[model samples]
Target chain A: MSPKGKTRIRRFSPVQRLFHVLLMLSFLTQGATGLSRMYIETSWGKGLASVFGGYESCLTIHKYVGIFMICWFLIHGLYLFFKIDWRQFPRSLFGPDSLLPRFEDLGQAIQHVAWMLGIDRLLRLDRWGFLKKLDDFLLRITRLPPLNRVSYLKEFDGLLSVITKPPRFDRWGYWEKFDYWAVFWGIPLLGVTGLIMAFPLFSTRFIPGWGLNVVFWVHRIESILAMCHVFIIHFFIAHLRRHSFPMDRAMFEGSVDLAAARHEKPAWIARLEQTGKLESQLVAEATPGLRALFYIFGYAAIAVGAFLLIGGLVNSPSITW
Target chain B: MKEAVTRVRLVYIGGAVGLLIGLAVILTVPVRLARGQEEVTSKIYRYRERVATGYYEGYEVSPRRARAILETPGIKRGLFPYGSSSAMVRIRARLPDSHKGLKFYYRNTCIECHPEQARNIHSVRAGITCRQCHGPEPIPAINHYYSAMNTIRRHSYVCAKCHEGATAAFASFYVHEPPAASLETRESFPALFYTYWGMLLLLVGTLAFFIPHSVMVGLRELSEHLSFSVPHTLMVGLRDVFKKLVFFMSHSFLAGFRKFSQKLSFFKPQNFLAGYRKLFKKKEAFKNETDNAP
Candidate 1:
């Protein structure tokens, strides 16, 4: 098979793909049912609510889906715990493959913003030195060694290699790290507040009389922020980006085009090839039928997300003004 | 492999149908309330029983009725021409001579039995006299008192009558009592008060930073991807978005119709029996094959 046709990079494991599907399903369900109740006064919200059998049913579905999400959230944590070779210990957490943010991610984020703003073009300055100093300072505070990017590029492919080489992010981008942690931060807050609100009488036994009010506010604000972030920012980064327009199949089929991987994740690709693990990572490309299924699921999720965001904004008080 | 894919698709269809049926069943189910207080207390009304605790055996309406009436609005202003607070003056003004022309008279007979309750804070504040809450006629309360007290212990039952919007803020909590007197006051629940403020700040701070960051990123992408001066590029981008929306809507509509038709076909007796037999028969055949292999 031609190298271009070969799916030689496994971007996601089958387990990870399964988790993604579950997350997508639960998140979309939660968003749809949640926004329906939140904006029930609006026509769109009302219509959506009636589809789910009115306000009471929306509440029921939201609660049940929320419980499901929290369960999966805990399960995901356990999955990660079990997957780790304890021998790798702290390395599993701090290593290049880790989702945890590192000093280099800050440099990458800065570089990205600089590139986006055209600041990088105006200055041929050794911006790396400045970033390295910042990274050193961060290291001093965080007490973690800087991650070294091991490149295995046998033959550099001109401009693609040059641009991707500068900020050689390993496995995960800084934004991707932010995306992962945002869920970590959000789920617990939403879950705790949701549970408190779910079982208020029990909660009130320990919480003060006014504790329910506080819990209510936290849940509302956090959920709204979450919906906006996921529907707009996360959606744009994951699917609507130039490279991944239409969809990012990596999370679905568990691989990306080796050529595309080389261009976008040069460091990760190079390391895999250098370690001679590249062949092991290879898998057959998804069949057309499977691809069709993925497209249906992906687009449905995107539509629901868009509906929630647009429907919410339509009735927002600020928009009326 | 093709058959496996078909089976997967069938499973998806069956799952969705099952979900819809489940939802229908749940929505149609009647709300079953807890047994009424009268039933719990064995048919004898609590107040009607000869009980003394340094207070009159106050006979208000049933718990359910009081709750329903409390939920009712504008009753205070409409019912009490002379403010509910000054029940004494209003009752005296309607004394003997004035009673002849009045449509309804204050039943001062209640205070005769329940004098101490008349001095209670809620009654005094709302100017609620006996008939105001107990009703001008006792017949309705007596009839329905045994039916149910479903609304009394409901979260925000009393407060929701007036504070409808605030009640919804914590509707999921399913609380059984009125809000605490302290509310958000720091003096009573300092920890909660601070946590609330902390959460508010976190929410505001995160959105403040991230929203602008997202906007900047969006703008940068637009600038990088499309040259706005070229009208063709803009047109192409918009056309792509429109095409996507059209494709999605039409595809979903068709898929829905297909599923509906499949469901309708499933109702056919032959198809139903065929499916049932095929499922179990295949399992049985597999069992025999395994037994023969061993």
Candidate 2:
């Protein structure tokens, strides 16, 4: 229950974590440079362009960053595929070992809903008693005008229950699979469009003028989507949700202990217990120095992303150097 | 285990084969371009040329892609790159009387054959048009007129024509200069197609994977009580649909189809993938042990 007795287990390797840091930086750089060019009329865009030494320099930066993004994405992918054990490959997808969705995830999802609704506790109540009366009273109160003001809290809490609740990740649940595959899937799109946009002259030579226009829209929309997704959705899931707000430098600190693992990834912990690998996988608590670094890097990135998102939406005119 | 290996190989090979087939198709079958030349003018969707009619300030619009300065409302035309949208403040001030004009709306009514129809103002030259600035300059007889990049003496005069026109002067609306048209006509087609479709497929795949979970998560009211269930989300949805299908199959007037259902079930990957054997066999073994219990 306390921090002292908590056990630690490794998630991402050093190489993987390093790649992630590089990825985050490259993506952020690419996004900043690209957006500046996209909305040069706006302050943020103009500021970025100026900071990077004008539009041409920004373009040069964007092109190089894009290439770095593509190269690293490839290296990460190849690293993954290089170690794919043919025998265990099947499990690597839908099995307990992989991030891919599987049938077991379905069971986990339903169970999570039960946990979310506190239905296990609810089920212990009698049908036509005080609990039902309480339920009826609450439901009726929801219809009243005065009480309706606070009734939104009920619905909001229901939604937050899903977000705030610790996920019991059995191996790789659908949500984790989603996050993993988001990078897996997004790399190609970000890479391909970034490449084309980088070499517009080379690309336009073969494609129709209007076709380039199409790529232009796709690239623009996709970039915005990626930015918004990372800023809002991914950030919320990874860091800002109730249990893990301000920072969740699990990536930086490098592991989750047995106590944290039991709550967050119960199925994984259970499997570890079943397989008798619990004590072996235990990592020591993180150093205060590393924790400080996580705060510096993690919170800094989150703050930067949030600022960019807000500034872009508001069309801030003075958002630059 | 074998299934995973087969599936991985299938995916890699399938991807390669798909790419090769797509390339072959694009190469062998020439691009059937609309060229925006064929007569698309109609009575319902009238194609009125805005500049030619000289109602430049009003509703007199045109359908010509090559020479069209502005387009008429309710018309299905290839050109109309100027997204037809303007800021509300700017509109309420300058185009107040002309603001009620319907031509600003996009008509995806004929978008399938005419995909360029899907493009709105935001897409074209930062959502403004040549006519909006230069005032209905004639489309040059040659596409090469605008083909040369950096060849033309740069001027803010064209920009001032619109941005500084009788309306308000925008803070800034600078855009990147277009690349040389020679390069555009040659290299752009494949590059555009690849990036556009590639991202589109990735988006679609993400959605396909995401939606089932979202939908299942949405059914929390039911799942909360039904703690032990077969599956959640897509699998459950599919099961419900399959149940209905089976029910209909058995009840329908055609009796032969009922017998075919069991035979057809064997072809389904889900039969094994669901790990039903784990559920049933475990249950049976549990039952046998319980029967042996005193």
Candidate 3:
């Protein structure tokens, strides 16, 4: 079939899809239940508690959700080890293809924001543009080493030479590297602290009262950061960024429209064109059933959250040590 | 790609090995520590028994009663034997309404043994004995029966008398310190006030703001990206809804009040004034533009 006329909708591998689904569920449960516990005196807390049967029940759900989230984190790390190209990972850090902030990126950010507010005309930038650059920076700073190291560049280069002939590498195509490390470190901080709070046995055994208090502080702060980042930053980039607004299916379909690939990720587009597998037309179609399900779940979550807030405020139960 | 694969495999193996070792240590360490704790606890129990018996012998009360007295609640086994005895005596006093107010004879026997403690027992008259309260005759059957019941009855009240007043037993035992105020007292009000404020802050942060904010943000994002297939979109949407609901519930009263106030005509005037000012300014700008155009 000719690439210009064909519709290509390649689905994500089952494992990847499963991981994404599980991650979304776990994060939602954790954020909701955790907020409820923290604000036990609020009406929302009470309502949430009522829906979950009681305060203890909501807490139990939150605890298990945290565990599941950590499990997903570990699984993701393992998957990265098996699937990712480590040689390409390190080289993408410092090269122009890297997501590391460039002098122009700062100016681009200002311009983008101005455009969003209708102050300036939009500028056509690279695939992972200014906003993505910021996201990459934040993810990099947040992550620990091994996943975010330039030290591996030499080894990666040596390996690359042995495997295949050299080709021009994108200076900024470091999504896999950034995403892998973000998951790696983010999970441990969230998971370890969450486990400590959920199961006092571990906290009591290894940590004293002061240590537990420190964990509480860190966990609470980290949760705030995670929620804010996911809600504002991740949401803006994944769905609200320029033409990608409304929805983007690259994560699920593992393919982009040739136009989107050409504009946003020219390197990937060129590769696709060379391979003669580029999808020409992009259709923005959402199944009715899927859309309905989204609305149902969305409204349901809001209703439950409101209930917890009310319950927490009205019946502020005394916490006995 | 091959090197990437190798590195990836190494991480997997390392992670698996680390997890296995951690799991093994977590599982085995607790059991070993518990066994050690069991041995230590047994030794401590034996030592406590010996100390308790020696302390009980020092008191003038019957050895049997002394052993039984500490078993009651609120009486620490070794620290206060006389207080324990007094508790037993008070319970015996309260039992029978028919018996003309029972007299507790603390002076004669207690004073003879411990002169210092005798000086503090002002409630007791100069001359009294165990028989004074127990009816002065050694009826073996009644004595034995009353002895068992007295330990149970006097346990709380006798402890209270010395532990209650300006010069309570507990006060005297320490350096005559005043008892701390109860939760309802003026002294406790500050703590309660702070607790209330702390709870208020927590409520505002978690329920009123954070949960709702999370849900709203999540839902708004989910709405924008509605193309993701079933379960994925549904899951994110559900989470968003939950957070919003929690936020609303947390701040219902505040929300209701805000809405009520916003609806009033008095509050509406400010908005009207602002709008009129903007309209007037726009008219003046238009006039300037027309004048300049000519």
Candidate 4:
């Protein structure tokens, strides 16, 4: 059959999707091998380690995969460099497209919380001059000096404005920014520490002997923390959210339903409309085979991640104690 | 075509870089293997006692308890005596009657049995006794059986026993025995010490924020999607308390309070009562209708 009509908006490019897959696979492998060594004394840990031939084999796999990931991380950095428009410069860095945190994100976070609790509805007023009323009330109460004809009260007004309407998502949400930065920070820290452990002789030459101990401790703790965040938080936001229950196939298929995208990322949609690029961004719907593959892969990943997470937690000192 | 060319260029560049790195890593194979062998050879005999101590500490069992476990029939006979080849041959030759006791007493001077250790650096330079350095009691014969399996590297806490001032001043973390070199003044390895604190802060700060944020967001999403409602009484009480607090803040209490209440219609007690009653009234009405019909 011919491809379906254009009802999907492109989200992730092919390269990004590829990176996501590789990263996911490597991360899972690392979690499995790393956690196995961590909880080696426990019977389940021993069992898991045995699957990879033993503790020694687990360490070897963890090391080699880690090295591969480090290389991949560098490649990713290079990919990003080549992708950026140097002519755009600061706009490419500081614009909405970038994942960097901004002042508005704080307000958005509060607005999100308010939205979640139904307080947004309570705060919203449909009458004219609501902004004026809010400004007057704030000025009367705080008695603070105005800020550039639009004080922090304007922020309150913005909050009310944002809350009154449906919460508009940009290209990246706060959660997505967090997830991106976590990996960005985590990869270098983990890679360096892991390399130190991998080549002790070289590392010890530069670092004091006890620095190795500290490195090992940080590596383990950070890994556990990462596992907890990804399996619980990342999984929830990406696939388990109410709107995206079962799975979000955007990353898998490189596009999202136009209607869903419009609802979820109104700001992005509006920008696209303004630029008249929405039509070009639209793609034919994913084939059934592709959808099936994604579902199978997504569910499998979730299962593996959950298993590793639970296994690690169960054998952790806190729970075991 | 331009995008394709850029992609091709990226692929070539990435491939060339990857090949170089791969080759570099491959070149290190021999060196790493040689280094590995050297490490094993060096550590095997010199720090056998410390390694054995680490192995014992891994069990987290008391010496008395370990003795009891080892004393069980068929187990003690199966246990090996020493970790190192030198220790096995020499210890067996020197301490023929030593295996008689199950209790490990550190009082035994290790140098007497293994006098070769007297020439060791700590002994000759520092005038440190084998008993003081390696504990007064060596590990008992029963526990020595598992010393061969002491693969986990352990830093010696034995150093801290004598270096009390350094331990007290610099060795704050009790995760393992502080490495002897680490117990210097802050000026020594200041960077590593600071990095250690920074790592700790990062770990704590990330977990502290992310875990709670995740949990709260998860719960909120779940609750909102699942349509979980707060208890009616609790909700009402909270609304009342909040209104009262706001009333105290208002310049004119009665008028402001009236306006505020008027503005937020949901704050009206009648609305709350009506909703609360509606929720229960259906169940009550159904029960009454059934009862009356019967």
> TM-score: which candidate is best?
4
Candidate 1 C-alpha lDDT tens digits along A120-182: 443332244544555566577777643431121112223333443346667898878887889
RMSD of 2: 21.4
lDDT of 4 by residue, A1-321 (tens): 113598888989999999999999999999999877766667878888898889879999999999999999999999989988799764455567877676556667777766665655545452456656766776787775667438665566676666655457888888788888899988998999899878754554444444555676668667866887789878877775544656788889999777776666788989988888887888997788988999999999999999998887777763221
Alpha carbon lDDT at A252, candidate 4: 92
Number of clashing residue pairs, candidate 4: 4
Off by over 4 Å in 4: A1-4, A124-166, A318-321, B1-204, B211-294
i-RMS values of the candidates, in order?
A: 13.2, 12.5, 16.9, 14.4
| Structural similarity to truth (TM-score) of each candidate | 0.55, 0.53, 0.40, 0.56
All candidates in order of TM-score, best leading:
4, 1, 2, 3
Error of 4 at B137 (Å): 8.1
Say which prediction, candidate 3 or candidate 4, comes out ahead on DockQ: 4
**Colliding pairs, model 1:** A197-B173, B84-B127
- Considering DockQ, which of the candidate structures 1 and 2 is the better prediction for this target? 1
lDDT of 1 at B93: 28
Q: What is the lDDT of residue A128 in candidate 3?
A: 35
* Candidate 1 residue-wise lDDT, B1-294, digit = tens: 356435545665687799999999999988534111111123333454342222122331122211111221222334655655565444332232323333444554656645644544235433445444333442122113221112222223333443343221222232322222234334434544466567667767777766667656654554454322322366558756865776788789999998998989878876999999999999999999999995
Q: Which candidate number would show the highest lDDT if scored against the true structure? A: 4
Two-chain DockQ for each candidate model = 0.07, 0.05, 0.03, 0.07
Which DockQ-derived CAPRI band holds candidate 2?
A: incorrect
